[model samples]
Target chain A: MKFHWFAEVTYGHTTAEEVKNNHTWVDAPATMHDPLKVGKTYQMFIRLMQLADRSNFDGLAVNEHHQTSFAMSPSPNLIAASVAGTTENAAILIIGDSLALYNPPTRIAEEMAYLDCLSEGRVIAGFVYGTPMDSTFCYGVPPVELRDRFREARELILKAWESPEPFAFNGKYNKLRYVNLWPRPVQKPRPPIWVPGSGSVETWDLVIDEDYCYGHLSFSGLRSAKPVVDGFWDYVDQRGGDTNPNRMAFTQICCVAETDEQAEKDYAEAVNYFYSRQNVNPAFAQPPGYRTVKSIAHDIEMRGASSLSNEDRMRAARGEMSFWEYDEKGYIIAGTPERVRQRIRELATDLRIGQLIPTLHMGNLSEELAAKNTQLFGTEVIPYLRDLWADQPDHWTPAVSQQRVNANMPQVAGVAGN
Target chain B: MPLTTQTVDDAQIRVWSAGSGSPLLFLHGFEQHPGDAPFLQRLAQSHSVYAPELPGYGESTGFESIHDIFDMAMRFRRLVEHLGTGPVDVIGHCLGGMIAGEFAATSPHLVRKLVLVDAWGLWIDADQPADPFVLNPEQLKQAKWHDVAAAERETSIAQSHPDGANAAMLLRQQNLGVATKFMWPIADRGLSRRLPYVSTPTLIVHGESDGLIPSAYADEFARLLPNAEVARISGAGHLPQVEREDAFITAVETFLAK
Candidate 1:
């Protein structure tokens, strides 16, 4: 399994009271956020990711969210530029740019290629339709046209990256008289693609058919994700699609310390803050046509009959779940490195997740604690898990960085899948 | 009134028709086809009423083939040419108003007179219309009507069609999902540019208290057209015909009579 250090880059100073007063996404109040603090927050993150690169993390992941105080990153490519320029080994995982929202669409190909050159070819291109709030409401791409726009953008970006000569390209959503890429990506064809989705059948079909990495990037842990993840694997197997676990990526929150008690003491308040501060208005969360009737029907078929109710989700988000309960429910993998390592091993094995994006920093966490968590997770937990999926080859990441990380990997004997 | 289906340009479009006299086309609003609402039934009494739920709306098909607002306008033109026995008087509401304007603009010969009720197509910079998509149900109800209680009297395609268990839900999704093509970012789709070409005399009706698209937008629409009139219905919101049907009818009938 590959270890990627990740964080949402939440505007760390937002208060739970402020979240209670307004939504955390879409039309979340801009007046409540401070620009100085936001810049400081980004600077702090760069330093932390720099540390993560040195600590032997195989990749560092960043994502895009718009008009939300909870997540200040509107452009993952800009953040990737900073990380790619400053860091050496970790893949600059942009999990991703909302494809449909871009004009000309070649902008993504140009920028990702630029980053690839800057980092000597360590970029993972994540194509996403974006969340309903980000794509439909903030960016104003119609929900019905989102998938089509994404499809056109995807085809355009890929062709722009690899096509040697300029060509006339016309699409339903985007039309270009001349298509050419100035600075092509260092990777031969293009950067590896990873697409994240929220259990949409169309997205599953897309990733499966294209053979791109599929990410179930939910903050909710195993208990909530089990059904959807299981459904994905079943669908893949049913379609005779590539069932390589390396093609599957999952995100989890990790809190590690010297001891179990110390871990709890260190992470409890931030954990509660992280889980509790996200308050989205039900209206903003879903709009008409955001999810298709077919996908909604599939969701009902899969989850309508399931055991978990709305209340369990509400409880988890409200910070009502005890720290231990959050752990027990798989919301977070916490405590000593041994415990976290053991839990992640079980999680990766059970879910068949080859790529693990352990979010080391979340809500209101001090920079100091996040650094310690990232370092500890990289050094103590990662080396042990290499033997789990070591047999399988990962095609999702750039070879150069993979080789770099492996070259410096700590040669620990007792920690191999024990 | 009987719900029927018609084929236009190889696409199946579900239509609702009733009454008889001169050919009159009724285009329903953004949220849905009003089905056999009292207002539509009233309109039917004066003329032959042919209200086709736009393609991809309700049991209507061919949404996948539509690429943009121009394709949408062309589809409406084709549908009108297929359905109308003679040049028709057109009444459009909300999202349907935007489509109806485009139809009249594209094929003026197919339209005699046009009525736009609380329509969307113009954007006012200082007094921007409230985003209809973002409003919650309660906010939507309030934005759509001066008196919230009036929503109970409104009927939708869901109420009219009971073919399957989840038919109502799915049909509504299809209807609104199709609407996003024109209304998603902003309701304006360069219709203002085409409005000048519509030589047919038009009437713009606005609910005085419409929170969604303020009466200022009606004024803007009137200014852009070749010949147009504005009627501000008092004590009404977005749907003037639904809120104050008697005045709405009186104003529309008087104008069309001229």
Candidate 2:
């Protein structure tokens, strides 16, 4: 399976005081963590890209979130552009711009198409309706209106990218007299798309129906996600759909060292810092619609259905339910080579996860620690996992390109299959 | 629309031709084919824009043919007739624009609208025009001769470096060398006398800051074409499309829309 490292590029220590101390620094929300300056972030991202390449990683991933301490990537497109210029042959994946946040979707289509040309067609477009809280309040998108807007934008972007020149599109979110993207991507029919979520009912349903890859960003852990994944499989089965385990991918906090004790000692503080920051901000911890009765009901049912321990629920309440908990039962996979490998293997087999995307830079972990984890994982865990999947033809492959995924576009618009 | 590629002797010619509108046959300058100009992409959204690959560009073949502007004009006339479309709107840029003016003079009936941009073949009085490709010490200082301050001037042309030499190569390789060689050249009779003879609407687009061809040439070119209207694009040098694309597009759109 393909492995990628995700980072929020959080400025571990830039506080409200720093902005207040300097008039030129500009005004910022006291509760938010802004991204590092363009030049520094660009330089840091380039270094990460080189490390990703050295690790035999298939892709370098970046994403978008705004007005919060959780993620500093407000313009993922800008980050994608930086990555595009630095890498010659790696997949530059932007989990993408929030479609609901953009107006015409043509802007997304045009920018994505331009990026594809710049990278010679090494772009994977990720379409998402961002978390209701972050997108709605920060971006001013009404939560009730976001889903339909997202669907319209996604359809409009797809048509604009794939259709012949001088085409006209009159979708709800966008209308154009004529449509054509200059310097079209090298690949025909455009690039692949990955939808990001934690097994949200709509997302899983669409993943199965469309056959697109689903990146279950289960930051909380395997126990919280087991029911969701199980629900996805059960839904597919109930719908009489073809079973494809390779469609699912999970992202979790992972760190590795020579020994479990050493790894925990090295990582615990940073992991604790990451959670502490979330606790202090609380905005990241309590997303809008997250505390609603309906949402709480779903979480409770999912937790009970998965048979998770009460400790996990209380931890979830304390905003520490993530796998990084020291109980060895959390979603986090940390420790010695053998210990971490065993945890990953358990999830890979029992959970049937096709790929494991690691967020090694959580809580602004030291660059040295992040790089060390990457090197160790690349040199150690990957080899072991490959061996386990060697004889299994049904296992998913790690490398993917957008051109390959965009080939099967929805030919008939507005028709739901499956 | 019909796309046909045929052998014009040893050279392969590619043409996108169709319909019974004003037959506008367009030719782009060096390193540029029909696609580089979105003028056609946008115009095609409306009128019948017939863009062909000028030899050695796009899909057209011929590393060496049409030695000068005169030769290119002759070959273009045959293309207009071969495509079986009528009274043409013959448009060209740089050396190609000079050839279109010559084509209008020689085969007056073939063209209905003659448009030229930063065209060559007209020599303005020793005004030290901007040669975006060459600085030659004197031109470098002269580039700063504008009314703007020296600091702002340096910032203005900072990105214009690296491309100065490439532009000079276009002059030496295509236009200058061939113009010096042929006696029956592209700029034969200045076409100034033929202005009244040619019954066609004309538009002469000149770059305001064109160093290769002075803005004065637009007036000269417009005065030479009887039915011509003149428009100047601001902040534009030799390649107006690159510097002021929106303005260049709007000018062309306004003229064509009329």
Candidate 3:
């Protein structure tokens, strides 16, 4: 299985008390953020990602959120641009640009192409209908029109990337007299596409029908994700889509150290900070018409099977979980590298996920420890997991990244003294 | 009156209509269409009240087919013409009030008189209306009524939707989703520009305690129309007709009579 270095890039300066006072993390007050601290945080993430690239990680995943201290990245492209020039390996995974948020979404095609060229053809284009808070509340997109806008944007971006000559395109949401990308992507047709969804069947159908990679992204860990992740595989099988595990990616929080006790000691406070700091207002979480009635019904049916209760989720969010309980709940895999690797192996196998995006640096983690975490996971955990999905081919990531990561794996192992 | 379906311009619309006298076309609010409410039943006693759920709302099929507020007004005109009643008196409340203003402005010959109650569509950035979309269920209840308990008395024909179990949820979303087209980012659709063209005698019935649109909008509506009067009903929020039916009826009927 491929291991990607991923983290929410949470603003580490805010405390749990401050978060509670701010009310909602997504629409938290502007005055709460110290611009200097935010700047340093961005720098820290970039430095950590660069280390991961040198340590043989396959991808550097960055995501987008708006008006939040939780994840300061409003645009993933800026972060991707930073690492693309500095890093020699790792696919610049923009997981991704919110399609509906961009006007005349050829802007996305242009930027992604620029990144691809900068990185020598290593870019994974992740198309997303952004969160209700990001798209509807922050950007003022009508929830009902969001999907339609995303669909139009996706079609436009794809067309702009592929079309050799300038073309006229008239769509419901966007109209372009000149449809041309100045720097087309280095990949022949386009970069590999990854679409992350939170149990929306429409999104599943979209990825499956187009044969793009499907990412079931959640912070709920194994227990919360089991129902949706398992349902996706079952649905893929039922629909006769390729059941190649490489096409499925899952995000997990991984805390690894020399020993199990050391891992807990290092990550406990940060783990609490990571889980507790983000409290989205219920209204912002669910805007009217964001999810279809059909999708809600599907959720009602699918979510009923999961053993994780709402109380468990609340306790987890409140940072009330003991370090061991968080591990038992699968919110984080905390232990020695051996233990983490074993747990992840079981997780990937059970979920049929070939791409594992392990969040290394969580909330309030020191830069030193984060770098250490990145190095350890990149060396110890990633090399061990390659044998798991060795038979299956991964078409989801850029080939340049794959080649670079594989070639550097032995060197990374040597650094680990293995 | 019973709920039924009507078609205009090949678009299916759910309609709630009753009573018989002078033809009175009632346009319900931005939310759900009021079913057999006391105000509607009272108005029906004196006039033939016809309330059609706006396109893209509950059981309404023309939402996709209609684009922009002008298109919506044109649909209203077509529906009125289809009714075979000439120059009916129009009463529009909240989001409906905004649409009624547009309909009266664009189709003056089709409308005899106009009534706008706690209307949206006029945007005063300085005194912007409370965001109806952002308000949660409890907040919405507080914003929409003088007494929270009155919400129980508020009626909707959509409650008996054909889609079983999740009908209330489905219809609420369907109706509000339609509202988001014109009222998403802001409630205004430039109806203020058209209100100046409406020469029809008008009444602006406002709930005194309307937190959603605020009473200032009622004054703005009155200020713009050629001949319009304002009636601020006491002990009511956004839905004056539901909260103060007698006062609402008296204000509207007096204006139409004049």
Candidate 4:
């Protein structure tokens, strides 16, 4: 199994009252956050990611969100550039660039290629149709045209990377006079493509048809993810597509310490802060045409008459759950390395997930505690889980980072080295 | 009054038509067609009314063919031509107002008189409009009506369809999705540039209490059109026809008579 380091760069210092009073996305008050603190936070993430590299993580993932204090990463490429320049062995995974937001899309083609070159071919390109709030509400791209724009941008970027000569291109959403990339990606054709979706069948078909990795990136943990993830695998299996675990990625918040008690003590408040601070105005959450009627129907069916009620979801988001309740619900995997390893193993095996993007730091987590959590998880939890899906080859992450992580990973005491 | 489906090229459109005299085309707001609401019925009393659900809204089809506002204008033009009524009086509310404005500007010969009610098409930097899509039920009620209780009594969604509340909710979502084509973002599709070209005598009917759009926009529209007048309906918000039906019909009739 491949492990990636990830976190939602949530602004620290936002109070519970602030979360209650205002939304965290689109129109969230900007004056609530301090600029100097934001800069320091960015530097802190870079420093922590560098630490993650030294501790034998296979990849470091970054993502894009706009006009939100929930995640301060408006431009994930800037952070990816920082990680790529500093980290020697980890794959710089941009989980992704919102394709429709960029004009010409050759800009994305150019930038991804530059990151790939900078990282010496260690980059994974992700194309996303950004959140409704980010794209339709904040960026003002009509929701009806968002998917069309994304498809056009993707086509343009791919052609730009592959075309040897300057070619004129005409697409419905984008028209380009010269379609050639100056610094083409080091990886032949392109870097490994990973498309993260919240269980849209169209996205599934695209990933399966193109043989790209598909990531179910959500903080909702196992119970909330199981139905959709199972639905995804069922769709893939029924279509006669590859069922290799390596092609699937899932996100889970990880809280680790020397003991289970210490884990809760260190992470309880931060985890609460992480979940509670994400206050999305209901109107901005789902704009018209953002999800097709078919997709919406499918989601309602897959969500099925289940135990996870709407009230549970609301309560969890409100930070009303106890830390142990949070862990029990699979929102967070909190405990000692031994317990965390056991839970993650079950989670990975149950969901058949090969790539785990474990969010180690969250809102208001002290830099010291985050470093320790990263260290413990890197040294203890990851080494034991390496045997999982080891039989299945992973083409999702760059081979260079995989090899480096494999070489540096401490050998399990009882298990034989590959 | 009867609801009929007409096929134009590859697309099918659902149109509500009634009465006979001068031809009048009624374009609905961002929501679904008001159906056989009292306001539409009242207008049909004096004039032949043709109210087609915009393409892609509800059962109407051919939304995929529309590329931009120009294509939308052409669709309406074809719909009017298909009606076989020579130039008609056009009344557009909210999103329909924007489309009606476009149609009048592009097909000057087809529109005899234009009425834009709480319409959207212009963007003023100093006085930006509130985003209709983002408002909650309470917030939307506040923005759309002078009296929330009266507006609730006038809501057409619950009474228009045979299906239950869930289906009504779904229909509302579908209608708004179609509205996003022209009204999403700022709702300004360069109509300010085209308004000057409209040759039809125009009436800008505004709900005085409309929280969705400010009264200043009526002046802006009047300033741009070649011949236009502004009429503010008292005790109304976004939907003047629903809130102050008698006053709205009188203003529209007076303008069409001219």
RMSD (Cα, Å) for all candidates, in order, is 2.0, 21.7, 2.4, 2.1
Q: Model 3, range A1-418, lDDT digits (tens) per residue?
A: 8888999978888877888877554569887788998999999999999999988789999999998877889999999999988998899999999999998798899999999999999999999898888989889998888888899899999999998899999998888898878999999799999999999999989998999999988888888889998899889999999999999989999998998888889999999999898878887887678888778878877778888988998999999999999999999998888788889988998999998899999999999988989988987888877777879988899999989888877633432222
Question: Would you estimate the TM-scores of all the predictions?
Answer: 0.96, 0.53, 0.96, 0.96
In candidate 3, which residue ranges exceed 4 Å CA deviation? A411-418, B158-166
Report the TM-score of candidate 3, chain B only: 0.96
DockQ, structure candidate 1: 0.69
Better of 1 and 2 by lDDT: 1
Write one digit per residue (lDDT tens) for candidate 3, span B161-257: 4766766776677778778888887877788888899999998988988889878888898899989888899999999888887888888888888
**Model 1 TM-score, 2 decimals:** 0.96
Worst 10 residues of 4 chain A by lDDT: A409-418
lDDT for each residue of candidate 1 in B1-258, tens digit (9 for 90 to 100): 578888888688888889888888888888888888888788788888888888787778888898877777688778777875778999999988998899898878889999999998888889999988778778889999999988888887644456666777676677778888889878888898999888899999999999899778988989999899898999999988888989998998899889
Residue-wise C-alpha lDDT for candidate 4, range B41-112, written one tens digit per residue: 899899999999889888889998888999998998999999899999999999999999999999999999
Deviation of model 4 at A98, angstroms: 0.7
Please provide, for model 2 over A1-418, each residue's C-alpha lDDT reduced to its tens digit, 9 standing for 90 to 100: 4566566666566543443343211124554433345346456656876676556555667888775555667778888887777665556777867898886678888888878888777777788777644565466553334566787888877777787766887765567888776656555676777787754576666766776667777566677678877777787789776455556667777879898777877787667555544422222233222222233445556767876677765565344643345436655789887777778887777777765777777665777888888778766766556533334343122133422322321232221110
State the lDDT at A322 in candidate 2. 38
The superposed Cα distance between candidate 1 and the true structure at residue B152, in angstroms, equals: 2.3
lDDT of each: 0.88, 0.62, 0.88, 0.89
Q: By DockQ thresholds, what CAPRI class is model 4?
A: medium
Query: How well does candidate 1 score on lDDT at residue A119?
Result: 95
